[model samples]
Each structure stands twice: as C-alpha cells, then as structure tokens.
Target: MGRKWHGQFEGEVVTDHAEYPLRGRLPGCRIKHRMKRNWLKMYDKAGWILRVETVINDPEEFRVRRRVRRRGRRRTEWVPLRKSVAYLFRYRDVSLQSNAQYLNALAQVEDPTAGLRGLDTITTRKRSTKALNPVARPDCQLFTALMSGEYAVHGFANRDLRSKLAATVVRLNDDPRRQSAQVSRLLHRLHVYGLVAKIPRSRRWRVTAFGQRIMSTSVKLRQWQFPANWPSCMTPSKLVRKNRRPNEGRSYAPFSGGPSTSPLRLVTPAIACATNSKLL
Candidate 1:
C-alpha cells in the first residue's frame, strides 16, 4: 500500500465465478497480489489465514543501523538488510507490522453486506435505466480515477475530480465547459448506479458501502483477472547507442531503393525513436 509499490504490482484477483478445476471448483477463493520479477505477494488461505509478504528487492528501503564493536568500542553503522542474516529479527518485525497494518485497514472498512443488497445492485438495470453503463469506456475510467487512494477517505467534488481525469481520460485541450459536462454525466450515473451518494445539499460525493467492494473488485478484475489466462506478450525495445554531431549529414534509403546522403533531420524524440523501430 506504500507509494513504492503503489502501481507496480502485476497479479490477479480471482472472482467467485472464475472456474479453476476442469471438473469441480474449490469453495473459497485464492487471491494473490504479486509484483512482477520481485515476486512480492499477499495471499489468503483456509478462509482465515492471511499473510502479507514482499521481497527486499531494494534493501535501501528497509535498511537500518545496528551496533557493532570496533576496536573495543561500540558504534552504530548502517546495516544493509539484504547483505546479512544478522538483521533477521528486524526483518521479521517489519513484516509483522506490515501485516498488522494491512489487517487494520481492512477492519476499518464496513462489510459490503451490512444491511444492504449484494453486488447485483450494480449489475441490475433498475437504477441505471439509461445506457450509461459505468463498467465501460469513459465511465469505467472515471470510476477508476475516483478510486484513487486520496479520495478513499474524503470523497470528492466534480471540480476536484476533474483535475485527476483531465489529460488522462479527458483531452487537455478540451474546453472547461465540455470537461465539466462530461464529468457531471459520469458522476450522475455513479449516483444512479448506487455506487456513490451525494452529501445533503452539497456537491461532494462519497462511495457507498456496496460501491467500495464492487469498484475495488472490478478494478482488480480488470487489471489482472480478465487477462490471467491470456498468452504473455513481449515488449520490443530498440537500443541505439550512437553518438553523432548534430550538424552531420545522414542517409535515407529504405524506401527509395538507394542510399542518399540526406541532410541532418531535426526530429522529435518520438520520431527519432520511430525511425529506429523503437518507442521512446
């Protein structure tokens, strides 16, 4: 939950409907939040056991000082956690603290089923009679933006939310009026969908209890669950380690069927990368 791994995790949350075995499915769910390469993960077992763990991929983040004897005198020096097993107690303490903090955060959240209907409240068309489905497109993106950590505790106003969506979901060049109108429509749908509720006589809105669970679950599903079974895709990188004078002449020939000493071309970093079959 810290900023270090805030958006670095790459894993999936298995929904109840997801099938595992070829013949029969298991009762409880196996949820995993993992970071690629580093393999940091938090998972549950037997419906009651919960464990929070992470690799010390970067020892500096958890490094501490320890006392050591030098020349018959005791002094403290920075002890890199990854470099020695002597600091295993400190490591265990930090891990337990993380687990406790995670549990405390979960305990503070009200149960989704506390005196309310199930997630069907969102799937149903009763509230959202219009075709404005938040689970899709611009609407979905807006929902994700609202679910940002800062908004979790204190909700948001349309004006405050606009800043988050602009230049990401909404075009930065768009006029202010257009941006406001778009956000207004999206927030309206959220209210109708029972995912958010407006404060009395105020423009502020906060996520409903049911919405907390649904949106959180949906985000996890979209990020990891839906693509869990898909074949892994490789990223193509082009490495150009050339250094040339800016005024030097260059050649262009791929399409003309002949090499020609062309003038040095001043191009954007993007175009330069594109010319070399790379993406900057």
Candidate 2:
C-alpha cells in the first residue's frame, strides 16, 4: 500500500495502478458506491494505529435513475455520484539512519571510483583497467565548471558550458568545428561516468556532492596547493582601487594602520616585518 502511493509523488493518479499494477496476484474488484457505516466508525476510532483500513466517500461517474417520467415511464441517465469505498493505508516512520544505507549504495552506483582510497600506494581496485578510467581533459573541465558556483541553483546546459569553455578553455580553429555535437557527447560521457546528472524533464546538468569533492581534491593536487587556514585575504570593505601606477607615488593605508605603500604590489609579511623593525 505504501508503494502504491509512491506514484503520487511523480504526478501519477492515485487510482492508476501504474506503479503497482494489478495482476493475477490479487482478485479483481469493482469500486462500490455503498459501504457499512459501522465499519467506518470502527476504523475511525482506531485511526491512531500505523496500518488501518478506512471507508472514504469518493465521487465517481456512473448511470443513475432519474425521476423525469414521460408516458408513465421512468428514465435512467449517466451522472456523477459520491460513493463510499474502503481504503487501506500502511504508514512507516523513516529516519535519517534508515535512509543512510540507501544513499551510500546510490553513491557507489553513481561513481564507482569515488569511494576508492590509495590508488597509487596502498590499495587498488580489482578488475579495473585504464580503459575504464573517466578522468580526462573534458571531464576535468566539466568538474571545474560545476565547482565554480556559477550554476549552483539551476545547474547548466550544454550550450552554456560550451560557450564558457570556448571563451576560456577549449580553443576553436578558424574554420570552426561541430562544437554543439562535441559538447553533447562530452555531457553524455560525464553522465555515464556519474560525474554530472541530467535534471529530469530539463536539459540541465548538476554535479553530485561526491563529484565536487573529488574534483576539488584533484585540482589541489594538480596545483601542488593545500587548503588555506584563513577564510580570505581581504574582505569587500578592505578593497582599494589605485587610479595611478605605483611609480606615480599612489599609496594606500595598510589594514594594520601603518605607513602607506603602493597599492599596485602585494604586501608580504617579510616586508611588513622589516618596516616594523625599522620603526622600532
């Protein structure tokens, strides 16, 4: 019964048996217009139970007898009628721990290589080959785009990523090529590898959290960089604009309220330390 109502989430009708189609397993029954009121009262009293059967008065279309008589004859016509029927519902309370196992299984299915550890030194997955590897130039680009936070809400489309790549990353020849087709194929490959998922009923793709984490780690490794201790070097309020070049003697005050220096060059700790030493 719980599975039968699951289709309601997907815009399917409750009466339709698409999700749990009726077959030879259960005996066929027609919807009845009348039900015992005593049974409904009993079910209502025990409504606090997890699983219970209740009688509901639902409207249905059917033929009904009409009082409009001609030549001493009664007539029957098709009309809508509110009828009572029996319905059984089963409920279960699901918690985060209960759903965690399913989520883990789904993640493994999405990206087979995501949970793997120590591919270079300690451990390696058996029955895996280089040919089955998914990380490539295009895949890297897609991952980077997903991590950029530009498409955080609506995801991204093929044309959107293609244009972005053409401007900054992928170089196109003077003659031009089938960029549209190439981008489509690239997106399909990413979907197959479970890096990006296509939104249902839409031509957009969103990166999974696992994909984002792996891409971020890969970028850090490639640049030989590590995560910073501080949140950011400067805030918006601290930003300053220089109208003139450094040689022109344009200066800005430091955040430490020390002597001003040229805004064009970066202020390193060593420079600040030397300045303080001289002042001392």
Return the top candidate by lDDT: 1
Q: Write the per-residue lDDT of candidate 2 for residues 95-192, one digit (tens) a residue.
A: 12223443444457765453564222112223432212224454455556667778888899877887677755555334335777777766665555
Residue 257, candidate 2: Cα error in Å is: 78
Q: Write one digit per residue (lDDT tens) for candidate 1, span 1-280.
A: 2323446545442322222332353343333443332323454444566556655555445656788788999999875556468777766666666566667777899886643354556656663355334346555666688788887777799888889887465454378887788778777877887788998887888888777777777676666765784444422211222444543333333433445664444433424445645322
Quantify all predictions' global Cα lDDT against the true fold.
Answer: 0.60, 0.46
Specify the highest-TM-score model's number.
1
Model 1 TM-score, 2 decimals: 0.37
TM-score, one value per model: 0.37, 0.33
Error of 2 at 210 (Å): 2.4
Compute the lDDT of residue 240 as modeled in candidate 1: 25
